[model samples]
Target chain A: MKTKIFGAATLWLLACGPAAAESITWWVPNWDEEAARELVASYEEANPGYDVEIVITTWDTMAQRILTAMSGNNPPDLITELQSRIVLYASRDMLTDVTDWFDRDLAREDFIDSALATGTFDGRLYAVPFRHDGSGLIYNRDMFEDAGLDPEQPPRTWEEFVSFGEALTVEQNNVITQYGTAWPFGNLDNAVVRYLQLLYDGGGTFFNADRTGVELDSPAAIDAMQRLTDTILTNGIAPRSSLEIDNTGLRELFANERIAMFKGGPFDVDPLVDAGMNIGTATLPGTGGIGTTTVDGFSVLVPGRANNPEAAWQFAAFIAQPDSQTRLTATFPANRIAAENERFSAPLLQPFLAQLDEGVPKPSAEGWGEMQRILFDHMQSILLGSATVEDAMMSANEEINALF
Target chain B: MKRSTPRRGFLARLRTDKDGEWAPFVLPALFVSVLLTVYPVGSLVWTSLTNIGPDGVQFVGFANYVELFQMPRFARILGNTIVWTLLTTLGALILGCVAAVALEHRAVVLPGVWRAILLLPWIVPQVASATTWKWFYSSEFGMLNHMLMTVGIIDAPVAWLSSALVVLPAVALVQIWSTFPFVMLMVSAGLQSVDESVLEAARLSGAGPWQEFRDIVVPSLRGVLFIVSLVIVVWALNSFTIIWVITQGGPAGRSSIFSIYVYESFRNFDLHRSAAASVVLLVASLIFAIAYMARLRRQS
Candidate 1:
């Protein structure tokens, strides 16, 4: 019996060793612990021969960590990365060119054109998008009903939005009791991106057709920023104080019913639901009959130097499978067919799915950090009364032009 | 003063110290210091001259330095660093001196209790303190607004952290509270050494309390004060955790200091620029360090 036990233990140790097994290091930005663990278990069950070591990372550290790892000889086989980081890694010739690996459906019909286009630069594909997220307006159903507006009908136009927002603003004794909306403004620079989305939705493009010029000097872009700022600061609907609160604090207030509506994404969904809000979700109201919002999420990229590039690609492609994606992530898959199915869609996400056309990709550029800085600086100037809408947009254009 | 070196030849000394195990005793620590401190600093200076980032780096000489001066964001960050350092140090200094002077007075009651209470802020972990301040600064249902409004001093709740003005002061307050204890401890030590005979003599000779402080106390405590100032300068210059946790230099990038800016560059995958920014911060700190050393030399 002792001999049998010793032999079994030795066999287990041999199987566990890296030399014996084709172990792939998969890096992911940290998320729900239990859910991630469950998904990993399912994957391990499915792929019996292959072992997946899921390396969890934080958002703040992800970019630097991945880059440092890649610079080293023994980098991870596969990495789930941010779109921002993907562009950086791809620019450096660190990622494996995935042109041959991409399936026909992934190229032609399964994936949306713009979403697929974001992962590729110039001519070669460098990454595959894992999950997608962007912004939308989450309103209080009770607050809308109390304000005498139909909760069922959400705002579709900029005019209707302003009017509804005005009706919801509650003030007494020169103090706001309930704010109409908390469009987070100032300091944090998240507000700047939201302003860009507003600008985009207003038929304003930050760049020209060739992705070379700075056209943010246009009147439409100027008007979009001005309207957003005025609505928050000058106008009584959205509070200027919302500018002070960071994203987390603002979300908390929105959850706690202090704010009637919030500009947020799916990450805020479950939290709001847990907080007991009668949530009425809708796409961002637009000026030119089309809505736009900023998209933020991870991409999968294989490093250039891999012990097993084929195995890495296989594992990556496996996770990105439509069925696998639907099972794992809270996000709608890049696969268009997966999106059309109610089987893949969760209950709270029905509204986001309905307004799928509103999901426009944010502009891709080599020096995105610099571009974001210019965009953020102008947006703040608009809030601080240092610059008018036109001036701010023009400033952004000039700065970005100098950069890109 | 105690060394006995009577007519010993160099050969005799060499023989006396020959094959000494002191090499084994001190070499490990010396080697560690060389590895940890010397090597990294040398590399840091080298990195500052290079375009080190996610992509491969190449030697850029002083281009990073030239760009540092040219970048408006760098200027903003520099100005922020100066203001934040000055404000935090000045605030910490003033409050600490006052508390120390107050504690020096024997007429003050419950000195032990007061000392314990004062140390409370410093005793808490920095992360915990920062997180608490973040909650305190929250606009909706924040402890600050709640307490202020409940006192009936203000009819409406003010957003304590959203406005640029309020956030700076609130962050400063947290730092002030956390840091004053160190200064107080130092000052109190310095104060005890202030000769009681000298104070009594001054009082007997018609020196007022102000005169005693300005003349006797000031001159006597100058050494401690100088040391304290140096420490505060370094702390204030690098102090980012409290502000980072509380505001993260936001509400329109109003509070982006040098340290925070370095972090931003790193976050944005521009660590080459971050390294360059770090050199600028290092130079600023080096100036203070040199000044502190000069003061120490002057005292000696």
Candidate 2:
């Protein structure tokens, strides 16, 4: 009896060992690194032997470095990526298909199945999300009040947005001193993300369900891209200078009070608050019949040569649980129970939590990575007033079509 | 062994009889030349033929060449590259030569101070210089517009980098400004070697100042000019950092040149395109070098 008891205890400890013993490399992008660091510290304290080594890089270099590392012998044990990108890596055979891992350790029933679907491509789970992402209109309360617009009433519809954006647009000496609203088209991902949200809100398809071709040249999309382009060039609500700024650059400008209303993710608010802005946040504007937001988050994965896949799965499952997901949740908690908790109902956090139903992962196309550059050059041309909307979209469509 | 010694004597008997000692020096140089130049170039030529796109490479047998010639982007890049190299070289050469001639007289308040200041640009790191220029072009809060507005030169800050019409000139200005010091140093060294007696002889003849410079000083500096031009062309072709840091070959590929194009092709995981682009540049440089050498021979 004593021998059997001792053997059982050893098995239990070995099974529970990842929470205790393995050091994993966790690649973190430009999100809240400080919060991620704090999240890991508590984990280290709870689990004695295991610690995560955080490899930090900016957004531009992150994708390249991750791809470079995957080709080498040892890849990161855990990677944080947007929901849209989870499938791209899995398709490349760079990730572990965690279908059985999720079955034995976790389940879609335990987390928000829709959000988890982003990490699942073709019935195999590739990533487990750690945080949430949803974009909305973040405006300057002071600017709105000063401009004599209602601080409580942000734009609710597309038509309203155009007029609202125009009201805040201030000019001096025939040059716009302040921009009303702007979407930065500098980085390929952000442009795609924001555009995806716009298209979805406008009742459009990013691609056909099979992901065979682009739906960009469709009449609805032409209207959306054209109107968006018009908001800057023809409407004069946004400045042409916006094309020069990337996401971070745009956020910095917002923090510095150069832009009046910023349409960005929940991660943007804290920085503005830190910069001492009287900021107001809300759900991103909607159109047609549906209100849409892009649901994106990072996830942890087990690379090949994981010292123990079982242990990695246990930790991944444990983190997906409400206990861990709630604590680690910055924008979206994958756990439905954790997402509804009052603890996540803070000012900007409320929008991300509230917008969960509207959130959909941006489509993951096979050659979507190359398609981004094709999109960027054309988007830039449109923004810089180099080409008409039709011509620019046509060039973009042709280039994207060639990617196959 | 005795016959070997006599072979050198016989080789002297073969050609250039008095200069048999050159055989030893020339033979080692020939061996070194084959090892250094021939092997790497042979390898480069081999790789240039293969389609080595970002992921990995496969042998494609001139497919990279065919693709390169067909791409309109490559033609645009090639044209921009020619303009960039010519403008930078000619601008620097003219400015450098004039400064060297002027400074030779020691006319500045403190000639040593002025010379030290001139060398400052050359000593500055390329990245640091590029970064400074990038800030100066920044639209949000650049000092260029502050100065312009202060003087009432323009009502608003001109978008220097974002406009295609202005970007190439802006990039060329950076290159000419940063590299002129190098030309100055080279031309200064060459100018010091010009025979003062030749200047006196030209004046003694019917030649005026312009004729004197054209006939005497220029001919004397021919070797240095040829070398500087050759190096400048290669430098300009291969340079990626300044343009990469500043315009990023942007304002709609207006400032895009061969190096930036090659680097971007590699950046986007299109390695075959990069290799092909690099081979094109290598061949262009070789053609320039050969032309320069022939010119040197003819001038001599």
Candidate 3:
């Protein structure tokens, strides 16, 4: 009788302890963790029996960490990967297909077509985009006025762009005191994206219609490569030091008044405004009367090995809603409804919003990153005068073709 | 004890039964080593032979190795690895030996403080050092260029990290700076084992400082130098932090090394190729490791 009473007391004590809760781990870039944490809190409040643990990760090591986790079969239930990497992950079978969620839970028409296109692979949706980012020209108004150019009107054609750059460049005794623009001539993301924009503006495609062969040796590509190299070598508008600069470095140089103009996305507006700089926005210059730019962004994905994929999808869907999207200041929302909020239509983001109509997503082929590296190296060679534009483009074309 | 007379042979005593007394202590360690070291290495080798990609893992034995060998970049990358390892290792050793010998000399003052100061490079984190070096090498606003310009050394600022011709050497200089301190500390510790009486005898024999160093000091520190060199060779061969932070093997792959090659492949999601590259690096490192072990055995 005493043993039975003791057993009953142990069972009661065990029952009195906190209940076991299903937990889902979410990994996101460090930039948006504050808003993500708030979303996670709201997700937990709405779902009583589930808990969401958000882990902040940095861009430098995110790919390595994700690969390691996926190989070990211990990846987070939910992760926000750059749009460039989502297709790579899906191709590797590391992400789950969530086509049903788009069809049932959310109205597919509510998202911008270009933003939604980033998450699809082979007619199946493997991720949902939360932000939309694309490059544009951000010029210093004071420098524009100093150059005797109209501060309100920006260059629309390639000829005007070159002239404006030449006019804005300040030199003393043959040594450039102030660069007209920041052109990243090295193996930087800015250079790669800008090259893509140039290619698009010239009405060129990276891959052929069937997506089997690269068309880098085409006339449009040659033109883009030659123009980019001339911007540094012949035009002397951008500094030679740009060969060592990245996208972030470009922005920093522009902010420090080392450069008068540069290219960046909507996210750069806030910092420049906060730093008390008079900045003006303009669409990226076009080649043949068609202004175009490359769009790149981040998407949320549920890992294939997620213990509770349903819960992870629920959290992803929740974050994609207009309410949560409105809070993101770092990037413009991909959701059309959220992007229509009064905050995004301000003068600072007006040019970027107008650019959405002309923004083209980067090619989502496998081995695209490697192809980018090849293109970057060849472009650098051309800019450094080690290789001619035609030769570099031909070599890049061959290397990219060999990737498949 | 009762069954001792029934033992079959001396060789039979080597085999331990499952319930043997040493099993509890030895089994855990053996299990852990197999789990951590042996299993992973085996897996790496296995993965190198397979195409573990989007379509899932498939057996493609030696295809990855063949492809790696055929790639034009592989030859350049291998040559770069050799050049980088030899230069960085030797550069560090020479600088380290010089500093160590200088500090050990009787005429030197504030020996303790000097030794500590010399060790600052190795103690400081690699990322911080790389970042500082990047700023110092910046073409527009670097301290080095600014100082050179101030001293009228050059009419124009040199693009230290941008130009392909100068990038590899520039990165190697940073590697040399960061790692020589480690060599210095090791050599300094090794110097404590050198006998002062032998040096005095050399001095009494009318030997000058250079001759004494060449004859007495080098012979005495040969063993220490050898081990330090071996450690540094392995370290330099596997060095990634300095190069990756500085160049990312850029300026048209002028500074590309074996480690960076492998890392770039992995970053591109080419796992099989990366594994093959790592295996090649392992083989290179293994040659040095075997030499080190053989020398160690001979000394013992």
Candidate 4:
């Protein structure tokens, strides 16, 4: 009888013991740490027997660290990475396909087309974008008024942009006290993006249809290059410092009233507003109508070696939901519904939203980084007056083609 | 009458002998060095001879090196590296020697305070000082341009970091600024050991200041100068932060150096190319290191 009783107790313990909780690790950028922590807390509260860990990454180390982590034996279950970088990992087989989950759990029509396209490689979804943005014409309204231009009316065409720039420029004693505008030619990525925007707006594709070579030698490309360089060299409206400042530096110049206008994204809105600057936003001026901007953003992905892919997908899907996206994204959320929220509906963001419809996703080819670097070098040559626009474009085109 | 003593084994002797006593303590460090430094360097060398890609690493001995050398930009980058290294080393050495000599003069007041002030550039963090200097060199809003224009030195701002013709020297100037203080400190330490009696004897013999400095001071500081030059040369070769933060070796690779090329290659996921460049840099640095070791051996 004692042996039978002990056996019964052991059976009861075996049946009733707490199950092991599944743990998932998620890596997020430092900017999203707080929101991610809050989301993790709520997720843990909503679901028992599951815990999610958060690791913070920064801009300076994100690319190399992510590549290293994904290639290692143990990788985070989930990661928030730049959308442009998702295809690189996907091409390497370092990511897990989530097409089924995306199709079943999310409404396809509710997300921005370009944002969703960044995560799709060879007809498979590997990531879910949360933030999406493109550049718009961000100008100081007061500067426009002070320069005798209507504050409400921003430039609509490329010619108008140059003429307006010349009007807004303030020169005293041969010193540009208040320059018209600037480009982010100092940074490789920024410089490339700006050039790409022009290239696309002028009807040039960075890569050929089959993605094996470049079209930078096309007439449209040369025209775009000429126009961009002429802003400083020919128009003489922009300061020479355009070659020394990135997007952030350009925004600072705008804030200090040293410049009147520049191209920037929605993320620039809040800071400029908080700084008490009367800013206006408009779609980027094009050769014809609204110009096309390069749409880039952040997305959540699951590593191929994740131990808890199901839980990771679950959390990723949760984050993809409209409300969660709204809370997490500093810019416009990828979900159309979430973007309708009052916070993103401010007048400052409308132009960016409108511009998104005409946006093309940034290129994510395997060798795009190197190609971009090559293009950046030649673009600098054009800006520095060391090479003609045609020569620079042709050289960039040949070099980029040689990469394939 | 002879007494026989038992011969100690190696292990037994290691515990008692003064020289051998350090063996046990050093084993851990030596093992760590082999594990950390030796292993990584071996891996770098092996990686340099292959093409690493998404599929797998393929052994392509000398292929990566050949490709790197065949590229036109490689020649330009090599030239930039040599120029940058020589320019920075010589500039720092001359400035450091001058500051050291000037501070040692009896006519200089509060030499310690002046030394501290001069060391400020070295004491400030590299990233912080480089960033500040970048702003100071800015063409439009830079304080340097502002001051120069205000003083009627120039009518327009010079694109210090943007002009290809001027970028290398501009970045080299910042490199010299931050490193000269180190040279000064080393030279100052070397100057302290100069025999006061010898200097006085030269003075008594009616040697002018320039003559004494040219003949006595320079000769005595030869060893220190050599080591300092080697150190500065190695530093300039390995430099990344200053140039990266300032110009990013840009305006069409005008300031491109080997280190920047390596980093850019790595960031672009061309690991094989990056490793190859790194191996080239390692070999270049090793030459100086070997020279330094040889000098040390000869001196000993």
Best by TM-score: 4
Task: Report, to 2 decimal places, the DockQ of model 2.
Answer: 0.21
Candidate 1's residue-wise lDDT over B118-231, tens digit each? 988889998899888877766655787778887988777676666656667677788888999998888988988999999999999999999999999989988998889888
Ordered list by TM-score, greatest first = 4, 3, 1, 2
Q: How well docked is model 3, in DockQ terms?
A: 0.43
**Of models 1 and 2, which has the larger TM-score?**
1
Chain B TM-score, candidates in order: 0.87, 0.82, 0.90, 0.91
Off by over 4 Å in 3: A1-23, A68-75, A92-94, A288-290, B1-21, B53-55, B105-107
lDDT of 3 at A380: 80
In order, candidate lDDTs are 0.74, 0.73, 0.82, 0.89
* Backbone clashes in model 3: 0
Q: List, residue by residue over A170-213, the lDDT tens digit for candidate 2.
A: 87776566778766654456676777777788778867667777
> Which whole-number lDDT from 0 to 100 does residue A336 have in model 2?
72
Model 3: per-residue lDDT, tens digit, A232-347?
A: 88998888778777777778889989888887889889899999999999887787453787887888889899888876876777776776777753678887778888878788
- What are the interface RMSDs of all the models? 2.7, 3.0, 1.5, 0.8
Candidate 2 lands at a TM-score of 0.79
TM-score-superior candidate, 2 or 3? 3
lDDT at residue B215 of model 1 (Cα atoms): 95
Clashes of each: 7, 2, 0, 0
Q: Global lDDT for candidate 4?
A: 0.89
Candidate 1: stretches off by over 4 Å:
A1-21, A32-40, A45-48, A104-108, A112-114, A187-189, A288-290, A336-346, B1-22, B52-56, B125-170, B200-208, B251-253, B291-300
Predictions' DockQ, in order = 0.42, 0.21, 0.43, 0.73
